[model samples]
Target: MTTEKCDITPNTIVGDLLRDYPELEDKLIEIAPVFNKLKNPVLRKTVAKVATLKQAAQIAGMPVAVLINKLREAVNMEQIQIEQDSEGKTIKPGWVDKGKIVIEYDASLDIENGLHPAAKVTKEITNLKEGEIYLLITPFLPAPLIKIVEEKGYKTYSEKLNENTWNTYIGKQ
Candidate 1:
């Protein structure tokens, strides 16, 4: 067994983790069947590189800490414990009224084309007027994208519409 060279944390990128420990692939899929998509070499290279364990956990509908600890254990690393935040209420916030949605971008097509939607989403987000909302429709919970826009001072709310559709509302604060 290889000595622990990398700390398996929520911020760890899936691709980087796999590169260091290819054996974790089955463990990831075991944690969530959704990870089976990683078997696709194209997605493995594209999405995995950009996706963090936190985002992967969100996509798997599991707690990020749980996912990280599981991966760590598989590699004989120390497990960590942290208070997991609630997934939040399903009730939409008052600022997220559908009528207030000024723009709607479905990023599933871009993802299918192996393109990241950050640039387009950021550009569209900048176009939002005060109190206006931009709706981003993606195939899964875009945790990293939400983090990016939120860091830029946008308020975001994500809701899973179905197994394959996630709606993320971005509002200018």
Candidate 2:
């Protein structure tokens, strides 16, 4: 018999939710197809460790309240409605200029080779000059990295270039 109940909240860590309620993986993917990457053993072990539900929502391009309510709804929890704009951050980065200085790092190869691009990207983002842009190309959305750099004042725009390619633009507004 199943013992764990889905206890997802705004602050829930993505990996913890998956580990505690493994069945919820399907539920999450159903809500956002981009979550399909969570199936990969490597990414699930690495990325999810640092990603919170809030960051996951940002990566999915959904408001935090919306994502939390959807997740809670999926598992029969009561929805807690909050004002829409309370947790807004990256609705759209008006700073992106579509210019050059793109630092393309395809993290899939690094992960497969046992190297993590988070550290490297962190160092690169620290060195970014105003108006400079870094385009992180990865197999999945770099949610944790976005959170870290965004806290340091970088704005971003994320888009899927293809099924296997997600490009996130990180720059200052």
Candidate 3:
């Protein structure tokens, strides 16, 4: 399942990219120091598998189009133009008021134990009533989990508190 150079786009998963072009791993970290986490075999096998280049760019605080184009150029592929996704969570949504947060769970320990927190977080969010917010704390952006909750019709907001802490607020729409 090698990815062709021409197919290197925002939708490409980080694991796929590194699997197809291991040489690009270093280039990725060079592009964004945050990508150094890829060096961990556990994360490379877990998070990278589900994280698309677009999400990776967002976590790195860069433009998805720029990240894709840079990787494209590295592989000798022509640059391209792609619209960025909305600048989500830049401003906290109204539903995310701290007073409305009824549940707060930190999944950092689970992540450190090589466990995925989707099911735990999902169950908690599923129990959320209208106007209630669930706060999920993690060591990194829980991109995959966020996508799952969003598909279930939940509005979400994520804020990075530090290099290793992310707060994701989920509310029923």
Candidates ranked, most accurate by lDDT first? 1, 3, 2
Tell me the tens digit of each residue's lDDT in model 1 across 71-95. 9999888899755546522345779
Q: Estimate each model's TM-score.
A: 0.67, 0.56, 0.64
Residues 20-105, candidate 3, lDDT per residue (tens digit)?
A: 88899989999999899899999988888878887798699887787888898888988987854475323455677999989999
CA RMSD of all predictions: 4.8, 6.0, 4.5
Q: Between candidates 1 and 2, name the one with more favorable lDDT.
A: 1
In the predicted model 2, the residue pairs found to clash are none
Q: CA lDDT of 161 in candidate 1? A: 79
Model 2: residues with Cα > 4 Å off, grouped in runs: 1-12, 16-26, 29-45, 54-67, 74-91, 100-112, 147-153
Worst 10 residues of 3 by lDDT: 83-92
Global CA lDDT computed for model 1: 0.85
Between the candidate structures 1 and 2, which one is better when assessed by TM-score? 1
Worst 10 residues of 1 by lDDT: 82-91
